[model samples]
Target: MPAGGAAAGLVAGAATFVLMPFERVMPPLADGLPDRALWPSVILVAVLAATVFVAVWRTGEPAQGFVALLCAGAVGCAVIAALGDAAWLLFPDRMPDIVPLNAGPPPVRHALSRMEAQDAYVAAIVWGGLLVAVLAAVIRPVTRRRTAALRTLTFAFAALTSVAAAAGGKSEAVLAALAAIVCGMLTPATAARAGLPDRPASTAAGD
Candidate 1:
């Protein structure tokens, strides 16, 4: 159960970290709704924290692995966000070149300067690594058959919502709703295999 919970936590933490930068950059869907833009990322963090808490309480053990995973996630996100922010700081004048949308003539397209392009490339690589981690976590055996299936489904939904929040460029309300659904589906099982009492097999009667 510890192993399974840790794996889930790691994946969730990675997703949260990788998507942090994009969340920061994404603007509110409308005026007077600044908090909506941050709901998805906030929900992810809250869910991860709750998962760690459950793992610790049910297993009656400290979730060191989960803690370490969260620490790594925080550091990774900070570094990536710093890199992007640095690029913007260094080339403040070139920032406007990287528009989210292009309203120009034919061949309507987004544009980015070399620095912005590099930053975006780095972001993509980070996101790719996170994706691989999430896939591995989903396939790994975490609990008994039934609980494992539920966990897998929950994690998959979380991964999808995080991706949509980061890349879909959709409305904040939509992202928030997706996040809420993922949270709703992520209720951990009460009786994990590790927490269950071991039972002895019955012996044959022909002794």
Candidate 2:
């Protein structure tokens, strides 16, 4: 991996760990929804999404591919998190449990409180995903291969596992901590990838 990529990942990971414990401080996301027990994952995804988009749009460097990976992963996670909303409306009686997979207290944390209040989940997903995807595709192709992609998946998976583990142990703090970690890992990779500079190969005659 390039020095920049490693540096970006380390920066992101450290930041995420620091921000994890603050989940409880955030407001609730949904009122009528069940399984509204906690807010860790919500904050993590939201932060990553915003940071990724900002980096890609603002940076003039050649890190578009990495930025695209980060932004896309964030959008994908958001969609997965809210999928239950659609399931609930489609089959009220059979609404798949929105409980964290590991089984924890009903969530009090609303990750999308601000957006959910003004728009339906469907609209949120539609707009967010569309915008992110369009931007990623429009950017130049990412040539760094699987490092960025795999790291992204690893961070998300770890964060999700934390949520489940916390739920199993009935520890809300754990969930928040993991969420922050995930966000940290994601933000810099996106930003760095979006802002990385390209160096031209030196010619033997020093053209």
Candidate 3:
């Protein structure tokens, strides 16, 4: 919930400056200024859990609801990594202090590695989340691209966090990259019901 909310906040916050000059209006968030705990990331975790909790009570089928909630959690996790971790990895230089989301000006990217890292993050979310969507069956699924967009955001959030954690944000990029890649593995995986519908065995990874 907050992951989606934050991404929308990040993008929308940044855009506000465009529609109305920064001097005339409020400011936008930088890479990871607030910390989030991911700085709202912790809050986001709660929101994500709530989505599942709602499903547990709201859905018609227990199995369907549990399965959907699990997918929602994965989407939330991917968003966390994509936003928080990716921010610190890319920005490396921006470690603005915690301010309101729109407290300061929208941030500008300054990292030398921003382009490559940005591309990788985009690819992972686009391809990774889409694959999950293609395969996943949930009671209520988020738009395919929306989940991917959330997953990709972890990097931008991570970059800001990196500057905070590392002070200088150099080697932190390396760790962020590695972590993002690994987290990519969790990019909203799909789960089939426990039993194969036909019990037909073919070549599968665990098989």
- Summed backbone clashes in each candidate are 0, 11, 32
What digit string (tens of lDDT, one per residue) describes model 3 on residues 57-148?
65445554444443443343345335633566665565333334454354523232343244333332333233233223332333344334
- In model 1, pairs of residues that clash are none
Give the whole-model CA lDDT for all candidates, comma-separated: 0.42, 0.38, 0.38
In terms of lDDT, the best-performing candidate is 1
For model 1, state the Cα shift of residue 44 in Å: 3.1
Model 1, CA-based lDDT: 0.42
Which ten contiguous residues of candidate 2 have the minimum total lDDT? 109-118
Clashes of 2: 11
Per-residue CA lDDT of candidate 1, range 1-207, in tens? 334443454455444544543323433232234554365466556656666676567657564335333333433333444455555557655444444445454223223343344454344334433432343343323334444454455455546545654774323323333333233223233223444542322321111
lDDT of 3: 0.38
Q: What is the C-alpha RMSD of each candidate to the true structure, in Å?
A: 12.3, 14.4, 13.3
TM-score (C-alpha, index-matched) for candidate 3 = 0.31
lDDT of 2 by residue, 1-207 (tens): 122322343343333333332122323333323544234345445545555555556554436535544444434434433442444445445322333444434342222332233233333333333333333334443344332353444445444544444454322323333343344344333432443552233321231
In angstroms, give how far residue 90 of model 3 lies from its true place. 15
